[model samples]
Target chain A: MSQSLDTRSSPGATPGEGPDATRQASPAWRRLARLALRQREVSIFLAGVLLVLYFQFSNSAFLSTDNLANLVQFSATTAIIAAGEVFVLVSGELDLSVGMVYALTPFVMFFAAGAGLPVGLAVIVGLLAAGAVGLVNGVVTTVLGLPAFVTTLGTLFLVNGLTLTISGGFPVQPTASGTFTSLFGASPLAELGWAVLLALVLQFVLNKTRWGLHTIGTGGNPVGAAEVGIKVRLIKTGNFVLCAALGGFAGVLDAFRIGSIDPLAGGNDIMFAAMAAAVIGGTLLTGGSGTVIGALLGAAVLGILKDGFTLLGVSAYTFDMILGAAILVTMAINVRLSIWRDQGEG
Target chain B: MADASTGRELLRAEHIAKNYGQVTALTDINLRIDRGEVLGLLGDNGAGKSTLMKIFTGFVKPSSGQLHFDGKPVELSSVSHARSLGIEAVYQDLALINELNVYRNMFLQREPVKGRFLGILDDKKMRAAAIEQLDRMGVRIPSVDVPVAKLSGGQRQGIAVARSVYQKARLLLLDEPTAAMGAKESALILDVIQRLKDEGEMGIIIIAHNYAQIFDVCDRVNLVEGGRIVFDKKTSETSVEELTDMVVREYREARRSVQAG
Candidate 1:
């Protein structure tokens, strides 16, 4: 028995010095490289850096202050929505109605303000309306035992129709002004600040809370999570609510930044981009694990490509082809990298 | 090292029976385990060993039964209810989230929280505690930071057992602790079980197929057949040959009845 224990320590010996005397004599730099490859967010962050360099080399205007700010602001919307999408994806669910909710929120706020409510209160009403859609999505998906994809798909159309009805299918200037608009999204870099802050906070929540741990466990193995007394339904429902609310908030921010709330804004286009950012950020499409910071970096990559392409006189129509190819390649790389890591360790 | 000594009664099942609609999974089971004792449950496939274990772990409720814990009558309404009373089971599946790190899985639903913050998990503290517990049990691993999916079968089983022990479970139920394991791995598990028995702090009920292993670590054995315990005896009073013969006779009778029907 003692002999078995003595031999068992050799298989999983790490590089750094430890109590296990049977540790393998691997070089420090090699181990460091292995660690970087093991962490998905680290690899994606590197990829984002590479994309920045590629864009800067292709188009000098890509690094200008004006273009840089524009890049951050444009990607801010995708980053915020992707951050929320991480929680839902990690909890083994999907929120397809986020794009529709994004288009619907500002309209809801505009209608509320027109009805004699204060702009601040109207914004709250907008958020509440957004949260209500999320609640309906959560309840219908969980309580009725419907798949979240189907449930959110139904709400997506419903919300799109509602936004069109409320806005009379026309783009309208937002009534919000002063501190409300500035704090929300009107000022330079305001949306960027919100995006970064929300990503950091959500990343901390994912790493340092029971809520995050349970979320991972629920998605990784629902039966195991339930066996350990975790309320799987509640965790999943909460994630759905979070994803939709973030989607709605992003929509409101976009409206404030662009100075207009269009009924047709943020349809399936933005929805697919946010989803792509999450997947490119190393979040598994099948769920179980994700990273918020990775999602932000992923959004940065997309933003760089879009802005860089426009500066280089590349047509807008070509961007979609690149986006589709990027998604496929990123996912394939993620799978292949993980398999290699496993083989190296084993 | 086996001796004749009476320990405090820890758990008792009285008239326990379970039925899945018209299918009788378990019928009229009466059993008891004492603190500092290792009781082995021997059974063929579909003979109600797992059903009985599920009832004990609060995963399944018997149609008719009364469970007595610590000499007091109690009702286990859920897995958490059983765990709150210090009754934990290491199931056949191990009930582990493979994507989670070893420390996280060890603290699964009951994560240690930082005192300053309301809902923040203290990963450092959990890692330290996991190291301590695994060290105490002589279960060696590379690190607590690695995910359980990256571990061997024996190491994963060790983590499950170590988690149950770390939670201070007074009654530990192990379902097939050594199934599918190689000889070396089984020896390691049996060694841990023997060490736990020597510590004399927990009442353990182990379900195993190997008679040799049962004799090696268990103080008593119960042979479950047709959803009922047909043979109950002290391990010291029986031989592997005797138990094997009994099972063979029962199998022959079952086969004859099947042919006739």
Candidate 2:
């Protein structure tokens, strides 16, 4: 009975029969290019490459294996946090507390270490502490129906203050140099490889799993998602927790890698950079869609740009100006691509 | 003849009333649909039609109501619970994620899972099934992989309807399915509704202002006014002219009262 219409109509008529015929007839190459442009990450990746090449030409040391390794190590923390930002952004939430979480977790680990806990156990506690902050952020924003930006922003300062109080406003220098630090805070290449691995797994989850699908749906249309039986609030809360947990994890990894924990190391600056990386990578702050791998490329762009400027004797102030310009140019291109897609097919 | 469809109650709502703080959204609403029934709910703006549908779909809690589904009294605690009982509603927005591709939007939170205790979405199965299911419903989209935002209104509506049917919804609520649709698109929805009605496993309640359109697909039509059902009649007992006359009469009376006030 359900198959009645299938037999009645021609078995295989495509959906293109109705909407704009000119678009249906557009050249395959043009369509392909438009598709590529629609993906903002591709352009961002190309921009990153161009920036790298420009630096390599400007200074021979820019592309050296050691310098490249340094770039990876420097970008890994921001990239790790960006992965979580991708989750939160795709689920239609802002996580402004990520930087403070990053700064605070290492101190949590340090205090736990001082209390005679194993490094592994301390790391776990630190991550849990970060996740707890995320839980508070999620509950306050979701359950209480508070605005996400305001809620997370308040939590950011609170976490930063807590970090200062816990570490007494001082950097907790590493007390032990052992396999624990070597394993987690390995050489730049190894840490970068691990970050990439985590990113790819998260990307798979975001693009493939039901949780990822629900997250996208929730962000795309909260009412529509709810109408379709999706747990929209739950998805948002989960993303919030995940974003904070990843931030905490990044702090732990960096502390172990650098052989010290600085309570004042990362502030709102790290959060802003991570958010910028996600945005540059094509993750819309407006939510619904983003790229995980794009975040890595984005972090690399910022990391390389900062390092290249220092190598080129450019002032620290100039770095912000260049980054701000890159964002405007990328966003302008993204808007143009969107306009093209709408005019082309819609 | 026992009139099996009319006798077998699929869903029943009694004395359903809803209050949003100081405002009353619905009051003294009694409604029901039986097996293989197509019930058309007619209402003006703010007549609480959508609110009632929301209550049915478990998106809102009624202050007081008793709902019987498939002869069992049940409280719909959540949208998922409603879905589990084979009740689904497609709103005027179509409840579609425009950014997502047709297949992904169709599956949404209910993707087909395969490996490791359903840990992974079986894309191959989902894509194949999306194509087959859409094909079965006679909805022609160029590709199942295309984003829904790119599809025509008719195609998007078809995808929404096809999704509900594919997911095994036994009681379907369609809020103004043909509101913004073109002639051909409206006909497509009517055909889908008629086909579903004929299948006898599903009962559909459609909210539409068009009396003629409702007459074309519905087995019965209920007119609501002031948050209550004012009149109800089977399609067999009501003609297009009679419905038009009654509605026009009601409109004129409403205008007179407003002018007097």
The best candidate in terms of TM-score:
1
lDDT of 1 at B48: 96
Q: Name the top lDDT candidate.
A: 1
TM-score of predicted chain B versus true chain B for each candidate: 0.93, 0.92
lDDT for A260 in candidate 2 is: 77
What TM-score does candidate 2 get on C-alpha atoms? 0.89
Q: Fraction of reference contacts reproduced per prediction?
A: 0.83, 0.74
Instruction: Name the lDDT value of residue B49 in candidate 1.
Output: 94
Error of 1 at B111 (Å): 1.3
Residue-wise C-alpha lDDT for candidate 1, range A1-346, written one tens digit per residue: 5543333232233322332332333355335436556676776676677678888988787889999888887699999999988999999988889999999998888889899999888888988898889889889988999999899999999999998887889999986657778778877578889999999999988878988889899889988888878999999888888888898899988888888999999988888888888888888877788999999988888888788788888888898788777777777656655654666676
lDDT of 2 at A43: 61
Model 2 agreement with the true structure over B1-261: per-residue lDDT tens digits = 545644688999999999999898888899889989999999888889988998998888889979889878889998888989999878789889987999888887778886766368888888998999988877888999888989988788889999998989999999899887778888887877887888887999999887676587899999888788888899899888888888899899999999999
Off by over 4 Å in 1: A1-33, B1-7, B115-117
Candidate 2 C-alpha lDDT tens digits along A17-55 = 433432444364344446555665666675677689889
TM-score of each candidate?
A: 0.92, 0.89
